[model samples]
Target chain A: MSHFTETEIAYMQEQKLGRLATVDAKGNPHVVPVGFRYNSELDTIDVGGYNMGKSKKFRDAGRHGRAAFVIDDVLLPSQPRGIEIRGRSEAIQQGGKEILQNENVDAEFIRITPTHIISWGIDTHPYHPSSRKISS
Target chain B: MSHFTETEIAYMQEQKLGRLATVDAKGNPHVVPVGFRYNSELDTIDVGGYNMGKSKKFRDAGRHGRAAFVIDDVLLPSQPRGIEIRGRSEAIQQGGKEILQNENVDAEFIRITPTHIISWGIDTHPYHPSSRKISS
Candidate 1:
């Protein structure tokens, strides 16, 4: 059984857009917003759009064996709640029709199987500065 | 000279965090939030945490050479102002005592070099959704 409550997974799936974090060749963190689809049945998340081998981010994923997918914003800064999942990537082709086409990528799917689930929604910050510091 | 404006870089640094787009081994898109540092002098961005290397998000970065980083939120359905950077990642280690104590990152640094920087601010959003779809 999964550790995540159905409500938690639902909350994530409901929000279609999230940020994908990757590593550069130099070990720097690179981030970008993207659209994703979570396969509730398979307990997997699907993400794609960049070319299989040519894209820089795709290449990084192949090199690095881990990554994080995050969603949600902290409105009050003091009360920051969000979802993050860690998983490995495996390239694949899906669908006969293309949804959104970018010159760099024609792949239909990139799936992630999460190992950890972190939720920081509770009031853990004692002050705004501390919360603000972590939120940014 | 860099194509990004001073204001843009400042905005990026101030936020200090972004959405990370990485491709999983399965060709799925993985999005996550990451804390980052931008060095204007070298025109590079760095991201790493003690346990970050173990995260799924990082694994995806190694898989996909092309990744995007986006800052700013979708306040209104129609107005989305953020910067998406296309780049590559190479792992580099700057061994130091401080790296071991603070970040737990024995390597000390990871860097990303940008090929294209896409700045989409309030000026670019058109009929975009106000709510962000969350995922894991």
Candidate 2:
């Protein structure tokens, strides 16, 4: 099977907002929405957000490598769908001076290497259970 | 001061999606998009999701009483905004027979009682940092 099932790939392409979650020093969970894209060449998700370099989510990810990225939409009037991925992550500048949409700030990027996938809906029939761990 | 700033309340009303983060037994953080409502009466956020009772998030909340719910939007075209609330949580079937739209399932409800609120970019100016502990 492919890294991402065809349906999952399609869902990611259509959704622009995803929440990247990480843990704090006290182990409290933190979730924040981000603008993201699936980088096909690297086969991983790349996320960038406004003022993200100074955000707590950035510091948390730097300290804690594991994260969960979820992209979901309930606006379709029907079939609320989402794709959830859990993996190790790192806050990286990656490839020199990536800029953000907001002025005067550099791009904040978190690279996720997924270990498992869990999803619901995002299909014609809808709400089928499709969760699996990636076998390296 | 009000528990929710005027700006935070408005943002919650406009957005239909929120990301809920909970910690698993291993302390791995899990985040999922949820359809939620800010119940002004109870001053809590109640969440319902697809097959949520059977989901890990539900179990995580059941075993652990802390969760963070974040709702964000970049729809304004120029700025991205988010509201993050930290609180204790639990999976409850409260008031008996809470129904799920998908049929044959009682509603899987997760309730979040906020202890703190952190937000940025929910105002006219956008990206203004607003973080405060809720006065209990």
Off by over 4 Å in 1: A23-29, A49-55, A62-65, A96-107, A122-136, B1-3, B10-70, B78-80, B84-136
By summed lDDT, the worst window of 10 consecutive residues in model 1 chain A runs over: A127-136
Give the residue spans of candidate 2 off by over 4 A: A96-108, B96-107
Per-residue CA lDDT of candidate 1, range B1-136, in tens? Answer: 6556776777776685666665656554556555666666667666665456556556666555555667766555535567766677544445322432344443433455777666656334422312221121
Clash number for candidate 2: 3
Give a tens-digit lDDT track for model 2, residues A1-136. Answer: 3578788898898887788889888888878777777867767877776566777887888788888999877646766778888888888864313422334444667778889988878654457747889976
TM-score for the second chain in candidate 1? Answer: 0.69
TM-score to true structure, per model: 0.52, 0.85
Give each prediction's DockQ, rounded to 2 decimals.
0.24, 0.80
- The lDDT leader among the candidates is 2
For model 2 the local lDDT of residue A132 reads: 85
- Per-residue lDDT tens digits for candidate 2, residues B12-89, read 877776889999998888987777777677778788765677888889987878899998776556676778899989
For each prediction in turn, the share of the native Cα contacts (below 8 Å between chains A and B) that it retains comes to 0.47, 0.83
